[model samples]
Target: MSIAISTALQSSFADAVTRTREALAGQGFGVLTEIDMKATLKAKLDQDMENYLILGACNPPLAHRAVDIDRQIGLLLPCNVVVRTDPDDDTRVLVEAMNPQLLVQVTGDPALQEVADEVTAKLRAAIQALGPTSG
Candidate 1:
């Protein structure tokens, strides 16, 4: 299975990020953390890269369910969603959500499968709500 659910956005990178945040919030997900990869790389390695941001998103209810199924699941809590400017075309942005099904596999628990499916659906909806690509 694909590791991520991704979509191309017609909007600018900033707008895509905002839209992603809003979409995720609509699905009961809150961004718990954000990492600006470009800035971090530039600061630490003196290497410039395309605009890229990673949003650590979590849906409390689903997270609680997963943890209830397996306490160790906290290691996978807060799914990651990445928004970045396409390297070949700065006008376009790409957004991808970490696939939650991996959690079921990692936990080796069939009980968590339902939780993973639900989370995956929510994440896919958020990405779809971003609309179509620029070109």
Candidate 2:
């Protein structure tokens, strides 16, 4: 299975990032952490890259359910969503979200399948909300 669900939007990098966060919130997810990859790479490695962001998103109830199913599931508690400029075309932005089903594979627990399916559905909805170009 694909590790992530992705889409391309014809929007400014900054606008795509903002819209993505809003979309996640509409689906009952909250941003728990934000990683500015461009800034990090420049500061730590002196490498310049496109505007890229990583939003650590979590739906509390789902997270709690998964954790209750398997304590070690915390390792994948928050789903990561990334927004970045298309290297070949700066006018377009790419957004990709983690696939929760991977949790079932990692934990070998059938119980997690439901939670994964639910989370995946929500994440997919959030991405689709971006518009016709979204996947």
Reference-based TM-score of each model: 0.94, 0.96
Per-residue CA lDDT of candidate 2, range 2-81, in tens? 88888999999888998999999999999999999999999999999999999999999999999999999998868999
Model 2 local distance difference test score? 0.92
In candidate 1, list every pair of residues with a backbone clash: none
User: Least accurate stretch of 10 residues (summed lDDT) in model 2?
Assistant: 126-135
Predicted model with the maximum TM-score: 2
Identify the candidate with maximal lDDT: 2
lDDT of 2 at 89: 94
Give the Cα lDDT of each candidate.
0.90, 0.92
lDDT string for model 1 (6-49, tens) is 89977888889999999999999999999999999999999999
